[model samples]
Each structure stands twice: as C-alpha cells, then as structure tokens.
Target: MNARTNIQFINNELGQPQFVVMPYTQYLELSKSKQIDTEAGVPSEVVNMVFDNNYSPAQAWRKYLNLSQVDVANRIGISKSAYSQYYKIQKLRKSMRIKIAEALQIKPELLDF
Candidate 1:
C-alpha cells in the first residue's frame, strides 16, 4: 500500500483538515528521525537547559559555546554591563535576542524565555 493509504485524517466542522492519524510504526520512524535531526551538533548543556529548566537558555548556550559575557556582548555590540543585566533579566527583547542568538551561532527561537 502507498504511504497515504496508511494515514487517516480528521476534519473540522467546515471539513478543514484538523488532525492526522498515522500508523504507530510510521509515527515511531518519523519521531526517531526528528530526534536525530534535533540532537545533531546540539551541545548536551543546551539540551539540558531546554529540557531540565535548571539554567537559563542564554547561560546554557553561552557556556556550551565557551563564551564569556563580555565576549558575547562585544560580538553583539553591547557593553558587558548591559549584557549582564539583560542576561540576568532572562527576558530579552526579540531583536536583541535574535542578535544574541546570531552571536552564539544558534536560532533565536532557542533563546525563548
């Protein structure tokens, strides 16, 4: 049977696609691939921060990348004190977060507070 034949779809009242149901085996396969994609080149510290919540995402990523506060601040064109304050706040503005993410070589979404 074709792949589509093994899947089921649920529609909303307007007949719009709302949910998908696939075979358990197919779901497992897809999950494994996605896990691999997410883990590749991802530092353990970063993963721990994302999953464990013990450390701020920025702190975790900065440590994982072996960067100091001053280093990141300089890269993002901010002063060390300003960087320290922002990092301590753990609630960065979106634009500043994106710039910091770029400095750290990571996606901005990963820095979500």
Candidate 2:
C-alpha cells in the first residue's frame, strides 16, 4: 500500500493495537468513504473561539453562528437569563447539551471539548 503513514496506534494491555489516531481531515475523509457521521469533531471556528476567547463550546458555537443568548434560549423554550447560566456551567448534562446543540443548529458532538 502506498498510503501515507501519518497515523498512530495505541496498544492495550495485551500489546495489540486497540485504538487509532490520525489528523481530523484524514479521519473525515475515511469516515465519508465508510458512510459514518460520528460527529465527534470540532470545527476550527469553534476551536479558535475556545482558545482565543476562553469560551465554552456552547458559547463558541453560539457566537460563531451569530445567535444571541436570547435566540437560543427562545429556541430551547427557556428565558434568556436561564440560557445564559448554561454557559457558566462547567459541564452540562447530556440532555441539556443536546438542547443547546439543537438550539445552535449544530451536531451535538461539536459541543464536546
């Protein structure tokens, strides 16, 4: 095979490769061929917001998508102040995370750090 060797293998206790790691772009390409939508990925825009502005994934996506707290809160059927409190939370529960993602109109995995 004439494939690039830009991948890594993590071995388990039995000395056999149990996990693989590679560049995000490469993984996306492979996933496309396999028809999988893992969505376990972050966008560059959201990543930059997290690093440059110290914002949470939810906050970052909200800003990137040009949606206001009130807008998302309305979508989630909550008050703006209540929605704002979610950003202050260190980690939201799965159901809340999904609600936030839905409000932001993005894949839930994008909100995962």
Candidate 3:
C-alpha cells in the first residue's frame, strides 16, 4: 500500500493524536475497503432522547429501538415491573447492566453514561 500523504492528524489537550482527517473521497474509498465497527458509537437521537426527555441510557436505547419495557424484561427474563424499577434506581449492578445490554443487543459500554 502507498503511504497516505493527504491525511491529517488532530491532537487532543495532551498533544496525542485523537482524530484523523482526510478527504471525503479518500474516506469513501477506505470505508468501502474496511469493516468499521459501527457498534463503537451511539446515535445522536439517543443522546437527544436522554437530554431532551430525561431518559436513562437504558430507557433511551429502549425507546430508540422502539421496544417496550415488557419486551426488555421478557428478553432478560425479568418481570416488567422489575425492569421499570431499574430506571428509578440511581445505579445498576454490573450483572444487571450486562443483562440489559444483552437484551438490547448493544455493548454494555454504550450504557455507561
């Protein structure tokens, strides 16, 4: 492969490169050739759902996926009311978080916020 000459590296506060900038045409080519992990990010709709509606991460994801609480509870093998309590609780257990992620088919890290 030829070395990239048009790419630009952007640094963060510590001066370590935090982003990569390239021509849109080059980006289109690279994206077609590579298998990007789409799961590594969340949609702006989810963020809006949280800030605009006061929804928890789980709640936001649930609404984003158009799933009802009963559906999530059924997926996780818990009662509907039990799942409802999760949103009311301040913090969730790691196991519960994992279970919720599995039910939503999303990475647990997405719910970390």
Candidate 4:
C-alpha cells in the first residue's frame, strides 16, 4: 500500500529546516513501520516490559531481553561494573546509548531520558 504522507516542514529563523509536522495517522504509520523493521520477531511481552513505566528504560529492556549486565557490557566493550553504574547515574553518552539501543533492537530515543 502506498500511504500518503501529508507533511509540512517548519524552518528556523535562518531558513534552515528545523521541524516536521505531520498528521497523527501518518506519524503512527511511520512509527509502526519503524518498529516492525527493528522489532520483528521480538516477543510482545518483551516489548511491553520495555515500555512499562516502573523501570528505567535500560533496566526494562535489559531484563526483558534476559541479558545480564556482563552480556551488555561485553557487547558495548565496557566493564560489567561500568554498565551497572549506568543505571545508578541514569545517563549515558549519546553514542553509548545508541549502541545499547541497537543491541536491544529498539530505537535510541526509547532509551533516552
């Protein structure tokens, strides 16, 4: 299906493009497609756990994926202790955050505070 996207670009004072405005339906369609591309075959229970509000984004995804801190640490080339500290600080360098999100098969923004 060819979906029609009605979009408008909002420019900054300097005339550079700064924002995009689209209909809610279009936004949902785009989000669904992106999620499908990234999350194919991931269990819905895992997705729900990741989206649960009680846990920090990292903790939720990590637990849902049944990954130990050491596992993520190894993937991101950091120490297990350092990875544990990420939850305490609730902050990660943008690049590291993106790496974690990639490891979890979700968008980076989902892990952002």
- The TM-scores of all predictions, comma-separated, are 0.57, 0.63, 0.72, 0.50
Maximum-TM-score candidate: 3
RMSD of 2: 4.5
Q: Sort the candidates on TM-score, descending order.
A: 3, 2, 1, 4
Clashes of 4: 0
lDDT of 3 at 19: 82
Q: Choose the strongest candidate by lDDT.
A: 3
Across 1-92, the per-residue lDDT of candidate 2 in tens digits comes to 68869899999999999878899898898877975454555657888988888888898888888988889999999999889889755467
Write model 1 residue lDDT over 1-97, tens digit each, in one string: 6554878899999999987798889878977777435423455668687568766778788987889999999999999998887774466788888
- Order the candidates by lDDT, highest first: 3, 2, 1, 4
Alpha-carbon lDDT of model 3: 0.85
How many residue pairs clash (N, CA or C atoms closer than 3 angstroms) in each of the candidate models, in the order given? 0, 0, 0, 0
Q: Estimate candidate 4's alpha-carbon lDDT, on a 0 to 1 scale.
A: 0.71
Residue 85 in model 4: lDDT: 74
